[model samples]
Structures are given as structure tokens and as C-alpha cells.
Target: MLEDLDALSLRVQRAVQLAQGLQAERADLMAQIQQLQQRCQALQTQQAAERDEFARMSERLARHDLELQAAQKESAQARGTLEIQLHEQRAHAQSLQHSLQASQADCDRLRTAASGAQQQIELILERLPGAEA
Candidate 1:
């Protein structure tokens, strides 16, 4: 009977030690769960902020694209106007060149006629007796 009592006491002691160890382990698990929950909340907040920033950037890109399109259209119109003006200027320059050529031809003919008149005047003077005297 004494031996039986001793063994039962030993079993009780071991059970109490095991219960304490399990309680310590549960406390550690609870602390780890709290830390994980906090980390998850922080990550969620960061994700939301990143999403908002991405949306803003997307809108800005769209606006920039629209502005670029408008600028390109204006540039194209300016280019067209410049091309038309250049064509007109080239045509005017061509007309002036033709007019200059015709004037040059008229000048050459007038010079030839003047030279012939001068030759005739010299012949008349040479034929006149005592003209130099």
C-alpha cells in the first residue's frame, strides 16, 4: 500500500509539470498570433495607399497623352500652312525669274539697235566733206 501511494504521488507531480509547460507554450503562440495580425493590417494599409497612387499616375498619364495629341494636331496644322506659303513663294519667285529673263532679252535687242544707229551716224559723218574741220 505504501508503494502504491508513492507511485500515485509521482504521477500527480508529472501531470502538474506538463500542464505548466503547455500553458507556457500557449502564451507564446498567442503572442505570435497578435504580431502576425498587426503585420497583416500594416500590409493592407500599404497596399491601399499604393493602389491610390497607381490610380493617380494612370490619370496623369491619360492627361499627358491628350495634351500630346493636341500639340501634335497643332503642329500638323502649322506644317500645312507653312507648306502652302512655301509653295506660293516658290511660284512667285519663278514668275519673277521669267520676267527678269524677258527684260534681259529686251535690253540686248535695244543695245544692238543702238550700236547700229551709232555706226550709221559715223558713216554719215565720214562722208560729209570737211566735217571734222
Candidate 2:
């Protein structure tokens, strides 16, 4: 009877260990999910800022276009002055446009990366026994 009691106690200890390990793993996974979610939010905010910058750049481009048209119309009276101002404005607009495009591309890339990370986390969670249910 004593031997049987010892065996039963050993089995209970092992079960407890298993449960503890599982709980630890679950906590780790939860922490990872939270960290990933925070990163995703940061990326989303950055994307929004980039989009806003793009909008501002577009507005600036429109204003530059209007200025260019006005400059052309005035060129007949002050050809040299209008031409210089037009060239400068055009150059500035081009630079802003390029910067906007680069920012947009970066935003898209970050969003894609965040999506991939989320998918990987989901996959990991799905593979876990309790998580699947």
C-alpha cells in the first residue's frame, strides 16, 4: 500500500509540472501577442502620418501648378524673372513629389510586414492545443 501511495504521489507531481509548464507557455504566447499588437499599432500610426504627408505634398503640388500658370502668363512682361521663379517652383514640386512617393512606398512595406507578423502569430496560436478550440 505504501508503494502504491508513492507511485500515485509521483504521478500527481508530474501532472502538476506539466500544468505549470503549459501555463508558462501560455503566458509567454500572450505576452508575445501583446508586443506584436503594439508594434502593429505603431506601424499603422506611421502609415497614417505618411499618408497625411502625401496629402500635404499633393496640395503643395497643386499650389505650385497654379503659380507656374500665373508665372507663364506674366512671362510676356517679365520673361527673365518669371522664368527663374517658375524653374525654382517646378524643382521644388518635383522634389516634394519624389519624397511623397518614397514615404508612401515605405508605409506600404511596413503594413505588409505587420500583416505577415500577425499571420505568423495566428498560425502559432492555432497550432497550440488549447488555443485551437
Candidate 3:
């Protein structure tokens, strides 16, 4: 009976050691689960922020597209107006050139007639002076 008691005491000691080891393992597993939970929460927060930023950028892009379309329309209108004004200015310049040519021709004819009249008056003046004899 004394030998049986000694063997039972050894078995009890081994069981106590095994229970301590299992407690240590359980604490380590609990710490790991806590760390994993924190990492998952951080990832979720990051994803939410990224989603909000994407929405804002999408709205801004839509606004820019609208502005671009408006600018294009304005540019097209301005280009058409400029073309029309340029055509009118060209026509006006052509008409002015035609008028200038007509006026220059009339001036040339008048100058030729005035030179002939001056020569005839000089000849008459010379004859009158000789008749003074």
C-alpha cells in the first residue's frame, strides 16, 4: 500500500505540471486573438476612409467634366463669331481699295489737263509782250 501511494503521488505531480502548461498555452492563444481583432478593426477603418475619398473624387470629376463641356461650347461659339467678323472686315477693305483706285485715276486726269492749260497761257503772255513794240 505504501508503494501504491508513492506512484499515485508521482502521477498527481505530473498532472499538475500538465495543467500549468495548458494554462500558459491558453493565455498565449487569447493574446493572439486580441491582436488579430485589433488588426481587423484597423483594416476596416482604412477601407472606410478609402471609400469616402473615392466618392469625393468621383464627384469632383463629374463637376470638371461639366465645366469642360461648357468651355467647349463657348469656344465653338467664339470661333464662329470671329470668322464672321473677319469676313466682314475683308469685304470692307476690298471696297475701300476699289474706291482708292477710282479716286487716283480722276486725280491723274485733272493734273494732265491743268498742265496743258498752263503751257497755253505762257505762250499767250509771250506774244502780248512782243506786241508792245
Candidate 4:
């Protein structure tokens, strides 16, 4: 009977020890679970921050695109105006060139006519009386 009691007591003690070991293991696992949850939360926060940064950069890119489009429009307008001015200047220069050519032709014609008139007058004077050889 005493031997039976001792065996039963030994089994009880081993069960208690096993229960304690299991409790300790549970505590360690719970701690690990808590740390993993915290790490997950941190990761989520970082993701949120990255999302916000991406949105901000996207907005900046959009604004820059708008600015680029406006600049292109302004540059196109400036180019158009300059082209018009250049065309007018070229037209005016061509007109001036034409006028210069006409004036030069008229001057040459007058000089030739004056030279002919002078020769005719000289011949008439020579044929007249007392005109020397």
C-alpha cells in the first residue's frame, strides 16, 4: 500500500512539473506573439507613410506637368508673334529693295538723256557760223 501511494505521488509531481513547463512555454509564445504584433503595426505605419509620400509626389508631378504645358503654350505664342514680325520685316525690306532698283533705273535713264542732249547742242554749235574745227 505504501508503495502504491509513493508511485501515485511521483506521477502527480511529474504532472505538476509538466504543467509548469507548459505555462512557461505559453508565456514565451505569448511574448513572441506580442512582439510580432508590434512589428506588424510598425510595418503598417511605414506603409501608410510611404503611401502618403507617393501621393504627394504624384501631385507634384501633376503640377509640374501643368506648368510645362503652360510654358509650351506661351512659347508657341511667342514663336507665332515673332514669326509674324519677321514676315512683316521681310516684306518691308523687299519693298525697299524694289524702290531702290526703280530709283536707280530712273537715275541711269536721266543721265543718258542728258548726255545725248549735250552732244546735240555741241553739234549744232559746231555747224553754226564761226565754230572752229
Candidate 5:
């Protein structure tokens, strides 16, 4: 009976020791799980922030695209207007050149007529009072 009692007591002590070791291992595992959960939450927050930044960048890119399109349209319109003005200026220059040519022709004709008239007047004066005297 004494031996049996000693064996029972030894068994009880080993069981208590085993239970205490298991409880300590469970506490360590719980701490590890809590740390992993916190890391996951931080990653989630970082991902959300990155997502928001990406959206803002996308919006900015869209606005820039719109601005570029508007600039291109305005440039095209300006080029068209400049082309029209250039054409008009060329036409006006041609018209002025024609007018200058016509005026030059008329001036030449009037100079020829005036020279002929002066020769006739000189011949008439020689035939009149200045004859042989």
C-alpha cells in the first residue's frame, strides 16, 4: 500500500508538470498569433493608402490628357487661322503688284506723248520768227 501511494503521488506530480509546460507553450503561441495579427493589420492599412495614392495619380493623368487634347485643338485652330491670313495677304500683294504695273504703263505712255509735243513746238518756232534773220 505504501508503494502504491508513492507511485500515485509521483504520477500526479508528473501530470502537474506536464500541464504547466503545456500552458507555457500555449502562452508563447498566443503571443506569436497576436504579433502576426498586428502585422496583418498594418499591411492592410498600407495597402489602402497605396490604393488611394494610385487613384489620385490616375485622376491627375486624366486631367493632363484632357489639357493636352485642348492644347492640340487650339493649336490646330491657330494654324488654320494663320494659313487663311497668309493666303489673304498673298492675294492682296498680287493685286497691288498688278495695280503698280498698270500705273507704270500709263506713265510711260504719257511721257512719250509729252516728248512728241515738245519736238513739234520746237519745229514750229524755227519755221516762224527765227527764219534766216
Candidate 6:
């Protein structure tokens, strides 16, 4: 009976040691679970920040596209205005050239008529009595 009681006490001591080991393992597993949860939270925050940055970039790109389109439209309008001014200037220059040509022709005719009149006067004067003397 003494030997049986000693054996039973030894088995109880072994069961107590096993229970303590299981508790320690459970504590370690709980600490690991907490660390994983913290890591997941940090990732979610970073993803939110990245999404905000992407939205800002997309808005900036859209504004730049609108500006580019406006610039293109203004450039086209300016080009058209310049073309119209150039055509008008060319027409005015042609009209001035025509006026100058007509004036030059009138001057030539007047010079010819004056030269013939001078010749007739000289001849009539020579035919007058003692005009040569």
C-alpha cells in the first residue's frame, strides 16, 4: 500500500507539469495572434493612404487635360485670325499696285502731248516773218 501511494503521487506531479506546459504554449500563441492583428491594421492604413494619393493624381491629370484642350482651341482661333488678316493685307497691296500703274500711264500720256505741242509752237514761230532773225 505504501508503494501504491508513492506511485500515485508521482503521476499527479507529472500531470501538474503537463498542465503548466500547456498554459505556457497557449500564452505564446495568444501573443502571436496579437502581433498578426497589429500588422494587419498597419497594412490597412497604408492601403488607405495609397488610395488617397491615387485619387489626387487622377484629379490633377484631368485638370491638365482640360487645360491642354483649352490651349489647343485658343491656338486654333489665333491661327484663323492671323490668316484672315494676311488675306486682307494682300488684297490692299494689290489695289495700291493697280492705282500706281494707272497714275504712271496718265503721266506718260501728258508728257507725250506736251512734247508735240512744243514742236508745233517752234514750227509756227519759224514760219513767222523775221522769226529766225
- What total of clashing residue pairs does each candidate reach? 0, 0, 0, 0, 0, 0
Model 4 misplaced stretches (Cα beyond 4 Å): 121-133
lDDT by residue (tens digit), candidate 1, 13-76: 8998998899999999999999999999999999999999999999999999999999999999
Per-candidate local distance difference test: 0.96, 0.96, 0.93, 0.99, 0.96, 0.94
C-alpha lDDT of residue 61 in model 4: 100
TM match of model 6 to true structure: 0.66
Cα displacement (Å) at residue 111, model 2: 96
Looking at model 4, residue 79 earns an lDDT score of 100
- TM-score against native, each model: 0.79, 0.51, 0.75, 0.80, 0.75, 0.66
Query: On residues 1-133, what C-alpha lDDT tens digit does candidate 2 reach at each position?
Result: 9999999999999999999999999999999999999999999999999999999999999999999999888876688787888999999999999999999999999999999999999999999988846
Task: Give the C-alpha lDDT of model 2.
Answer: 0.96
Off by over 4 Å in 3: 1-5, 117-133
Model 5: per-residue Cα lDDT over 18-52, one tens digit each:
99999999999999999999999999999999999
The collision pairs in model 4 are none
- lDDT for position 67 in model 2: 97
For candidate 3, list the clashing residue pairs, or say none.
Answer: none
In model 4, the worst 10-residue window by lDDT is 124-133
State which candidate has the highest lDDT.
4
lDDT of 4 by residue, 88-132 (tens): 999999999999999999999999999999999999999999999
